[model samples]
Target: MTVQPYVPEPLPPAGIDWEAHIPRIASANRALARYDGILQAIPNPRLLLSPLLTQEAVLSSRIEGTQASLEDVLRFEANPKEPIGDAALADIREIINYREALNTAVEALKTRRLDLALVCDLHRVLLSGSRGMDREPGCVRTIQNFIGRDAQIEHAIYIPPAPEDLSGALGDWEAYLQGGELDVLVQLSVLKAQFELIHPFCDGNGRIGRMLVPLILYDKGLIGSPMFYISAYLERNRPVYYERLLAVSRDGDWNGWIAFFLHAIEEQAGANGRKATAILDLYDEMKQTVPEVTRSQYAVAALDALFKTPIFSSAEFFEQAAIPRRAAERILQQLREHGIIAVLAEGGGRRAATYAFPRLLAITEGDRL
Candidate 1:
């Protein structure tokens, strides 16, 4: 027997039993608000949250079968000419593009509306110079697409909307995004599910859908920064992640999906808050220690760069950290001597020596890296 393609019904599923989810909704909102407070208190939220951003990129891309990690991306950026394999190099580029795309989208939301144009533009940035470039990065699909083992739609596990139907569905999605009065968290949960069901673009739908979580939150003023790390939760609960999404289409289980999303939000928000707090504390300590240890006026800048790219090359640190070359060298030496940064390689002739901040990496990776 052949399986039929799954086409989701339009938005605002009737009779959701919203009252049934009141507790989860309230908990998610409280967790998010607490996280937002922490974000507001950070001196420079972007700079401090930089490593967390990279971790987010890594986990998000991981969901799409990309093998790159935060370390891989920083190391690749540190020395693109290194002897890494082509496959690993491509994966690193994809991860870097994820960061670039997300950063671009967040910056755009500062002055622009969150609509299809912004989403498409973000998709363009995501696939540019990566493996998915040929899949029509910013363009909505003009052909049917499916997710599963078989190329034939009949054997596929899940099939998105027919290409011809995307315009109407996406239009309704964009409108609902702009006109929802439901609690923003619940609204965002539905929006993510709907976007995934539509699978707007030919490629990068999963990644772009995940990216929208933070984008929508920031756009709606629920979070001061778009630094929410949600993929970690989804990746941890991988089976249920796909199951809930499938249930939404197969069983019209919007209530169950929204509940799962709320639980993810609540749990990930708490974890993100703890990680952010720890990162900020480490940054504050380093701010004072690095300057004193290096005895260079540029120590603060160097420290900031290290926090941003904890695993990087000495040369890249010198050039991109916005510190004088000589001062950067001195800071690097001082950091190494004080056990703040560990040298991964001692550059001999032409190779740029690599470095890593163990404490910072540990904070972000949390014993996993």
Candidate 2:
């Protein structure tokens, strides 16, 4: 028997037992508030939290089967000319595009609301020059699509809305996004699930859906910026994440999914808070260490550049640190001697050497050296 495409109902689905979820809603809100406070306290969060963004991109793409790691992406970025095989290169490019797309969306949200147009633009950047570029980037699907084991629709585990009904369903989704809801977080949960079920684009739907999490929170004023990283939690609980989403369409279990999502927000917010705090602390420590190790007046500048790009080439560092070339070289030598920065590859002839800030990278990876 063939399964019909899942036609999602309009947003603000009725009959949700909101009262039963009061405790979870409160806890999630408190956790998010604490995280946001930390975000505001950090100086130049964009530079300090940069690694977390890359990790978010890596994990989000990994959920869609991308095989690149945070280190792989950074190393390849530091030296794109290195031959890392076609498959790995392709995966790294996708991961890079994820970060680029997310950054684009964050900037676009400053002047515009989170709507379909912005979302489509994000989709365009996400699949540009990657494997999914040929899947009609930045456009809604014109054909039926389904989630299943293989390409066969008969085996489809979850079929999204048919092509003809997509516009109406999406219009409702966008309107609901603009309208106010009692609980912004719950609204986010519904919006995310609804978009996935709608499956607007032929490719990059899952990624775009996940990208909207931080964007929505920022737009709703839940966070200072669109830097919250929830993918770490979602990726760890991959099976349950999908199960909760499927349960909504399979058994009309919105409450179940909402509960799961709220818990995700609560738990991930705490984890994100801890990571941000650690990164900030490391930044403070490096402030004194870089000066002590290199004994250079440009210590603060050098430290900031390293935090911005944990894995970078000698040339990149020279340019980013923006100090005299002689001072940069001496500082690099001192840093290497003191084990502050590990040389990933030695400089050869005219080729620049690559280096890694293991201590900072370790914090982002949830490990400490």
Candidate 3:
């Protein structure tokens, strides 16, 4: 017997039993508020939190079977010629696309609402020059698609709505996004699960769905910016994440999924808060350290540039730090000697060496140096 496609019910799914989820909802909200407070306190969140964003892109893509690590992506960006192999390079590009797509959406959200047009725009950026580029980026599926372990529909785990139904389904989803709910965080849980169930795009549905988490939070004014990093939690709990989503479609288990999602929000928000606070503290420490080590007027500028791009080239650092040629070279040597930065690749001839701020990178990776 063939498996029939799963047609999702319209948004605001009935019988959610929101009353039972009150405790989870409250906890999730408190944790998220605390995280947002940390974000507000950061002097330059976009710069300091950039590595976290990249890590999110890596983990989100990893959930979809990509094999690149956070360090792999950063090292590649610092020097594209690193012989990490074609397959690894491909994965890195996908991660890069994820970051670009996210940054694009954040900027677009500044002047527009989170609607389908903007979503399609993000889809285009997401799959550009990547594995799914041929799968019709920026366009909704015009044919049937399914989630399965094999190509045979008989072995499918889940099948999304038929192509003919996508427009109406998505329209309803967008309308629900604009309306109010019992609680914004619980409402977000619904929105995310519904999008995953709908499986709107042909190849990037999972990633795009995850991307919406931060975007929605920002658009709803829950965060100072679209910088939340929830993928770490989801990726860590990969099996349960999918199980909760599937449970919603399989058994009308919205409350269960909402409870799980709220927990994810609460837990990841605390983790994100701690990581962000660590980065801020390191920045404060480096302020005095860089000045003392380099004893240069450009020490603060150099420190800021490092946080913005922890892995950078010597030439790139000079330009970004905006120090004079000789002075910047001296400062790099001083930082290298003092173990403030480590050389990832050495400069030779016209090729500038790559460096890594291991302290900052370790904090972003949630690892000790």
lDDT of 3 at 225: 81
Best model number under TM-score: 2
- Return the lDDT, model 2, position 282: 92
- Per-residue C-alpha lDDT of model 3 across residues 1-369, encoded as one tens digit per residue: 566776778888898887798888889999999999999999889988999999999999999999999888887887776577889988999999999999999889888999888999999999999999999999999998999998987898988889998988899889989898879898899999998899988899999999999999998889988999889999999999999998888888998899899999999999999999999999999998999999898898889889988998888888888889899999999999999999988999888899999999889887322
TM per prediction? 0.97, 0.98, 0.97
Per-residue alpha-carbon lDDT of candidate 1 for residues 1-369, written as tens digits (9 for 90 to 100)? 654555656667776778998999999999999999999999888888888888898999999898887888877888888889889988888888888998998789889989999999999999999999999989999988888886777788888888888898999899989986678888899999999989988899999999999999999999988889899999989999999999988888999999999999999999999998998999989888988898887877888899878889888898768887777888888899999999887887889899999998888987332
Q: Which regions of candidate 2 fall more than 4 Å away from where they truly are?
A: 367-369
Number of the top-ranking candidate, with lDDT as the measure? 2
Task: Give lDDT for model 1.
Answer: 0.88
Residues 153-186, candidate 2, lDDT per residue (tens digit)? 9899998888999999999999999999999999
- Which 10 successive residues of model 3 have the least lDDT summed? 360-369
Give candidate 2's TM-score: 0.98
Give each prediction's root-mean-square deviation over alpha carbons: 1.5, 1.3, 1.4
